[model samples]
Target: MFSCLKHKVGEVLLPGDEFSFQPEDTISLTDTVKPEKVICGPGLRRSGDRLLVSKSGVLRTKQPNMFWVDSQQKRYVPAKGETVIGIVTVKSGDVFKVDCGGSEQASLSYLAFEGATKRNRPNVQVGDLVFSQFVIANKDMEPELVCVDSSGRANGMGVFGGGGLLFRVSLGLIRRLLAPQSPLRAELQQLFPHELVIGMNGRLWVKASSVQQTLIIANLLESCENMTAEQRRQLFRRAAQGAL
Candidate 1:
């Protein structure tokens, strides 16, 4: 059953694609059988004894039984523990409403920040960009965002200062960019020195030595989503040659 799904990894699967688990052909009375468990992430769900694809995209898997789909989704879906870049839209009482490119705005508490207290609050204001993680997120309930970790440290999550440019990209591209030792990020770093903040909700913030350089990087990233790896390499080569 595990091998059935494992073999399909990296293949394009559409909605309604299903896989069923079956018992082994032979079992020995003296041998102990360990149950195999598989974890389904976004785009895959379990129904009865079968696994079903809920989205149309390429199947992806992580070691030790984790599976999901990498899709070209423009809209963001809030998920618990996902770090996202949100724009503060309203400040109401103790909670701030943040737009995370989702169906509804997520609520961020003033006390969610590091070192924040009733007497001394974090200097949050409307129109500020916050890098926060979702503490509570589900389809039936409103999403909640927090800037601090369980240890009460910001851990790189907090309000963004001025000067960086924020832009949108496909969610699939965002996943690729965030992958371990990502080739796209590696090539970009080779081009120039820059600061990049990648949000799971398809938002990216980039800053370079000059406004022109920042725009150049942003455009390159936005354009490469549909290009093949070789095509991206060719474009990077042109950029390295000062072709821009």
Candidate 2:
């Protein structure tokens, strides 16, 4: 089953692409046999005993049997455990309605933040940006966001401060930026020092030493979404020379 699916990794697959699980190889009764399992991520679904592709994108896999499709999508469908950048749209009694670039606004409770309590709520206001993770996301229910992890620590999730510029990019670009040993991130580090916050939902916040430098980073990121590797290298070289 894994062999049938692993062969298509990194290939562009369209909707309706399906892979059937192959029959297990026969072994002696005395031999130890472990059950195999595959986890399907975004853009892939399981139907009966086959793995089905639900979107158009490149197939990608992670270690220990996890697979997903890397696709360029503007609309975000909330999935549990994915971190996202959200704007507080409405603040009610004890919850804030946040727009996470998803189909609907996700609810964020005041107690979701670290050290928050009934008398001590996190200072969140309307129009503020928040870096949070989805604790409850499903098609049948309203999504919920949290600023703390299971151990009740912030873990880098919280409200954002001023001075950074937030912008949008393709979901595929976000994935690449967050990938291990990302070439784009490495090249950018060589040019200048900057701070970047990437969200799985395509929202990015970037800040540099100056406003001009910040804009330069933002423009380069937006333009490189569809560029080839060589093209991006040449562009980066020109930017480095201009900065000197």
Candidate 3:
């Protein structure tokens, strides 16, 4: 029962001891006298008169559902329509390869660069950070990414420069730090006092008042991983409110 809540794979379930099933949820069950009934990864809960099961499984108690465990390996799975920040790593013919912190590299075409015209395509060099959306994840699981905005414009989608510092952190920490309600996020906003945060799956780009302020923000973001979700949210709120 205790192991299930921790999201560990291969945890065994006993009969009558209700366990939360799905991906990430707490397990609580009434101890049953019999041992024959047991299942894994299926939603189970008791109603007043009968046990209820959901085809989609249980609701994840974890704040962010972005994380998932598959085949006993922990990996970051990017969903379609999700906005992600990535860095350009290499260029090929008309496409640029980007590092999205996933197993396969994502591709952004030359035509997608801001201000690309029939005669003039903006030269986007390596190391430029771009905010993009997952356009396609083919059968092979390779992601095709794009950056065109709703109005069919590519402005505000490329090459972040100045006013901030960039740092690499673990993927898990990045997800926690980016939760909209995270306290750490709010605190970071206040401490640096600027707009426009671009968070990659593993890297962060922030704008600050000064270099010193940027360093402070980086340190704070790094420390947020060990904090609880609620605690992080509070800290972020305080930081955003200028308490940091």
Each candidate's lDDT (Cα)? 0.93, 0.92, 0.60
List model 1 lDDT by residue over 1-244, tens digit each.
6989999999999999999999998987897888999999889989999999999988888888998887888999999999999999999999999999989999999999999999998898899999999999999999999999999999999999589899999988998999999999899999989999999999999999999999989999999999999999999999888898
Question: Using Cα atoms with residue i matched to residue i, what is each candidate's TM-score against the true structure?
Answer: 0.96, 0.91, 0.61
Which stretches in model 2 have alpha-carbon errors above 4 Å?
A: 24-35
Q: Is candidate 1 or candidate 3 better by TM-score?
A: 1
Model 3: per-residue Cα lDDT over 1-244, one tens digit each = 3234445333433334334434335434775433223232234454443334332322233422221221211244565655677889997778899987777888887776556765786677888877787778654777978777656676566666655677766765665556779555555555556555555456677666777667657766777767777786776667557665
Estimate, for each residue in 11-126, the C-alpha lDDT of model 2 and write its tens digit: 99999999998876777699788777999988899999998999998998999899988888887889999999999999999999999999999999999999999999799989
Candidate 2 lDDT (Cα, whole model)? 0.92
- Tell me model 1's lDDT, rounded to 2 decimals: 0.93
- Could you tell me the C-alpha RMSD of candidate 2 in Å? 2.1
